[model samples]
Target chain A: DAGVTQSPTHLIKTRGQQVTLRCSPKSGHDTVSWYQQALGQGPQFIFQYYEEEERQRGNFPDRFSGHQFPNYSSELNVNALLLGDSALYLCASSLGQGVNTEAFFGQGTRLTVV
Target chain B: AQSVAQPEDQVNVAEGNPLTVKCTYSVSGNPYLFWYVQYPNRGLQFLLKYITGDNLVKGSYGFEAEFNKSQTSFHLKKPSALVSDSALYFCAVRDMWKDTGRRALTFGSGTRLQVQP
Candidate 1:
């Protein structure tokens, strides 16, 4: 089965510009989560969407938001991006919101802010 | 709060030798632990996970992890290292009791493993 897929393997945007990254969940998976990985650092949770509704969010600001479609595809939108927003945007999918479920990740979208 | 720490920045080992990448986690209540490996320019691949049952969990790539509750550590080990096994390893954890509706993985900084001939 096709695994989680993310588009625009690489992206470049200027400061204050907005960027949108897309993700298609793995086949048969429903929940989708987003993470931000800075250079040389571990990924930080951005938010999660389930059943077409946002389920949980991390410490990120309002500038970062996400949407999940009925087809289980998700989109990450960053508005008025800052230099610090330059990072790898990763998308992961799981069966449900449970501790035992393992998340399948996409190759990730590398966002470069100039 | 849940967090993970990979003690080593890099691990070097011979092709035939055993390898160990250490990881420690901090989380309240029962913890769901996981190990993933990433090759150059690739996404993270799930190696294994510790949910319950036996302390020893075997996963893909002939890799296994031992979960030590008292020490709050889950260390990944391989009996014989392969040159192709070289990659970046990450440890992650999340509390089972969190009300956050979705399970989020708290990842470590990652440890690079280099296997030589």
Candidate 2:
């Protein structure tokens, strides 16, 4: 089966620009979550989407938002990007709820804000 | 709020020797713990999880984790390390905040394991 897939493996944008990153969950999965991993740091939770609605969000500002479609794919949007927004954007998919399910991750989109 | 901590920034082990990466967690309810490995330029790969049952959970690549409830710690262990095992390791937990419904996994800062041949 195909694993979680993300598009635009790498991108460079200027500060204050807006960017959107896309992700397709693994087959048979329903939930999509986004994370940001800066250099020399672990991935930070951004938000999670389920049932076409945002179920949870992390400490990020309003500039970070996301959407989940009926097809179970997702898009993460960042507006008014800052220099600190440069990081690897990761998408992970899980089949079900709670702590029992395992999440499969994508290779991630490397976002570079100049 | 639920959170996890990986105290070590890096762990160095020799091939054929045992290795251990430490982790501690905090949560209001029962904590569901997990371990993952990440190679350079790759995503985090699931290794194992502790939902319930035994205190010791075994996973891929002969890796296992010991969950200590009293200590609130879950430490990843391996009997024999290989050079290929050298990578970044992360510990995470499924967290649910009162504000965020089913926020999902919260990851640790990560520990770099270098297994020398």
Question: What would the DockQ be for model 2?
Answer: 0.78
Check candidate 1 and list the clashing pairs: none
Docking class of 2: medium
Model 1 bad stretches (over 4 Å): B96-102
Question: Residue B58, candidate 2: how far off, in angstroms?
Answer: 0.5
- The positional error of residue A77 in candidate 1, measured at the CA in angstroms, is 0.2
Q: Distance (Å) between predicted and true CA of B51, model 2? A: 0.4
Against the hidden true structure, what lDDT does model 2 obtain? 0.92
TM-score of every candidate's chain A: 0.99, 0.98
**Best prediction by DockQ:** 1
Instruction: Report how far off residue B103 is in candidate 1 (Å).
Output: 3.1
Put down candidate 2 lDDT per residue, B1-83, tens digits, no spaces: 57899999999999999999999999888889999999988888999999999999999999999999999999999999999
* TM-score for each model: 0.97, 0.97
